[model samples]
Target: MTERKVIWNGRVQSDMVDYNGHMNDASYSLVFSESLDALMETTGLDASGRERHAYTIFTLEAHIRYLQEAHEQQALRTTVTILDQDAKRMHLWFEMENEDGDTIATSEQMVMGMSTTTGRPGPFPEEVEQSLSPLPKLDREHWPTHANVQMGIRRK
Candidate 1:
C-alpha cells in the first residue's frame, strides 16, 4: 500500500469544550468517529451501506494520544491510512492536525467485520474489500505511543 491522505475537517463547537477550555475527551472521539465515517464513505460504505451488505465494522481496539489542545472555533483536520487488513479485520491509523499542520492527536484503530443480522464475525465481502484495499500501510514509527490508556465509544 502507498501513502494516501483522507481529510476530515472539524469546526470546534462550544459544547465540545470542557472546563479546561479544550476539546473534551468525548469530543475527540466524536471527531475521530466522524472522520472514520467520511473515510468509509469514500469506499461506498457508510453506516447504512454496511447494513445493506449485512457486514458492519466494530472497533476492536484503539490507541490514541493527545499532543495539543484544540479550542473552540479551531479548524481541525484528519488523515487516515489503511495500515493492514485480512479476512475479518483491519488496522487503521488516523492523525488529527491543527490548521498549521501540527499534530494534535493520533489514533490507531483495530476493526473487525461482523454480520449485521447474525451478529457473528465474518470476512469482508470481495467487492467491499477490493474497494478499500488500496489504502496505505501504517508506519510503525508514526503509530501514536503516548496514549497508553484504553478508551472507546460504543455505538448504542
Candidate 2:
C-alpha cells in the first residue's frame, strides 16, 4: 500500500480529555476528518478544484476501530493509504499513531464524488483522475474476509 505524507500531526489537547482521563472518541474522528481534507487536496479536490469542477467528495460510509487509548498532550500522527479507488469512489484506510509509534486508532472510509449542482453522484475531472491514477490500490480479493470487513456480520 502507498502512504501519503503525514496527513495530520498534532497533540491531543487537555480540553479534549474525557472524564475517564483519556482523549475522547470525538477527537479521533475530528483528526481523521482533518486528515481527509488534506488527502482530498492531494487527490485534486481542493476548494479551488471544486469551484472549477462543480463537484466534491461526499462520505458514503465510514468505519473506525479504537485500537488504543491516548492521553492529553500526546503527539498524534495520521497517515492515509488508498485502499481501493474507482472513477466515482475512493476507499481509504488511516492509521493514527502516537509519537512512540503505538497505534491509537484505525479508520476506513468510502467516499464518492458528487456534483454540487446536480446533487448526484458524479465522475471526477479528467485531471483529477489522472492525478489519482498513480496512487496504490489494494486488491480486494486478497483482503481478509473475516468479520465485518466487506461482508455484513451477524452474531449467531
Candidate 2 regions with alpha-carbon error over 4 angstroms: 1-5, 141-156
lDDT tens digits by residue: candidate 2, 1-156: 334446778999998899999988998888888888877898778999988899888888878878899998889999876777777988888778999977778888888989999999988889888877765555766432321375467788
TM-score of each: 0.83, 0.85
Model 1 stretches with alpha carbons more than 4 Å out: 139-156
lDDT of 2 at 131: 78
Per-prediction count of colliding residue pairs? 0, 0
Clashes of 1: 0
